[model samples]
Target: MTADARDLARWSETLAGIARTGMAFTESLYERERYEEVLHVAGDIKAAARAAADEVEVEREVDHFVQEWMESIGEGVPGYVTPKVAIGAIVGNENSEILLVQRKDSGIWLYPTGWADIGYSPSEVAVKEVSEETGIECDVSRLLGVVDGQRMGFSRFGMYMLLFHCTATGGELNPHPLETGDVGWFSRDELPEATAGAAWWGSMAFAAIDGEQAPATFDPVRDAIWRTDDT
Candidate 1:
């Protein structure tokens, strides 16, 4: 997709997220009705953004997503909407192998990751995720990177991922019972099939794993943070 189209889609998703979050937290019927209208507008924007590529099924998919989003609303506390935070770990062993797991739901390979919990710090969550998902004990060494998950097409709602570099401390290899289908360690050149966004972070992750002075990565400042146009 063109950059402009991608920008439009992201905005649509952001607007939809705001509307849903509002619907969840607000008890006022009038406010909810307004939020519902925002949802409808978001759905239209999403469908139009997708339909730009001449896809016929775009409308159905967009409508279905909106309907599901509306149905999923529950009583939520009132606050400004924000992205959900997730933690991920890049665990590298002495053998220069990085740990990975295949998600049961998506069947795609990614580093150990999980939603942030209330009591855990970001690095604590990262360590916990690695152990829980891959049966690999790791010590959180340093933060590797932070990423906007929605912009990466990895989430339906807004999310930000905090990735950490970790050292394999101890543990036998075993996949999580319900979350993973398989888990393994791989070298830099031997990443598994169906890996998500490996091209972007693979080198940095490997560098950090290798004890190199790897700088953390984040999205660069865009000319118009919200717009895709060059000028």
Candidate 2:
């Protein structure tokens, strides 16, 4: 998708999040009305973005976005809007091959990843996700990268992907019966054509796998925080 469409969607989501957070805390009727207005405007922007991206009139109404955001509102800290967290593992075997899985829903190949569970530490989530998705018993070596899922086009909603490098201690290539369609160990040069986001993450993953002593990577602050292509 073009940067404009993505930027519009991002902006709309940001506005909706802010408004929802405000609504969660404010007690004044006037303030709630103001927040609702903001939500309405945000819905319009998101709908326009969808239409622009698809190059067709969207049947979904702007109220769809508003209603979804409204349903997510809570009364206290739970209502504080923030990006959702997901954990990803780049597990490498003794052969220096990377472990990847084909997502059942999208058929796109990526490292084993899942939503961060509430009770587990981030690294624990990484280990658990790998085992659950690919039947790989892995130990986290280090943090590999922290990436924005929306900015990377991996998701439409706000999310932070915590990527970890891991060593595949044991397990066969047993794909999860539900989550993954296939699983395999692939050399860096032979990554499947359908592998997702390899351009940005592939080199960093391989570097960590190769025993590089480097700091964990993250998205740098943009000069214009709201701009689409600032990098």
Candidate 3:
């Protein structure tokens, strides 16, 4: 199906409205086969706007389009639609041993992390997750990186993850009931069989260890596999 320039302009304008309100666009609005159509329209609008030579107006429109596109179909809820936030922590001890948790539901060993709740910032979400999962009090230090866990299938609810470097402030390591079965500190060399998905372990660890500020979004399906310096 061919998308006309007018259609593109209209979609672009609609997207701008969506961005302004932070509204989620329902996937049900368009069938799966129509995704390509939408994408084509978006591209045409972008190209025409760019070719117009009105740089400022074009940029504004492009920014609006990008923001709206992200707000609508960026991440969370593959088929339906919703906003999701996730948090990950680089929790370590005085011995520099990083803490890991074995989740009860998935039986995956991952860093203490979970979805961001309604009333918390991303950092607060990380701290809350750490405390809830490991019974540890931690102070969020710095943002290690943000990763798109959606493509990697690490996110259960199609959420994006914000990873943080954290310091254990107090409290002992006590696994949360049912949510986590085990909690342990592992040295860099003595990592456990991670119950968390491979992508989470790989990306979170690399960002924390190397102190890299990765892109805010990474689609594992489109991006290359996570690789360490040696790899």
What do the candidate models score in CA lDDT, each in turn? 0.84, 0.90, 0.62
- Among the numbered candidates, top TM-score falls to 2
RMSD of 3: 13.6
Q: Per-residue alpha-carbon lDDT of model 2 for 32-138, expressed as tens digits?
A: 99999999999998888889888546556687889999999998788999999999999998888999999999899999999999999999999999999998899
Worst 10 residues of 1 by lDDT: 72-81
Model 3, position 231: C-alpha lDDT score? 34
lDDT of 3: 0.62
TM-score of each candidate? 0.83, 0.96, 0.55
Candidate 1 lDDT tens digits, 1-231: 555556667888788888888888888999989998898888887777777756645658777768976876766764455788999898999999999999999899999989999999999999888888988898988888899876776664578999999999999999999999999999988998799989888988989988997677887766687766675
Give candidate 3 regions above 4 Å deviation.
1-83, 197-231
Q: Per-residue lDDT of 64-162 in model 3, one digit per residue for the tens?
A: 545445455543334234336778888877777788998787777778888788888888888888988898898877876666543443332235678
- lDDT at residue 12 of model 2 (Cα atoms): 89
Residue 87 in candidate 3 has what lDDT?
A: 83
Better of 1 and 2 by TM-score: 2
Off by over 4 Å in 2: 55-59, 228-231
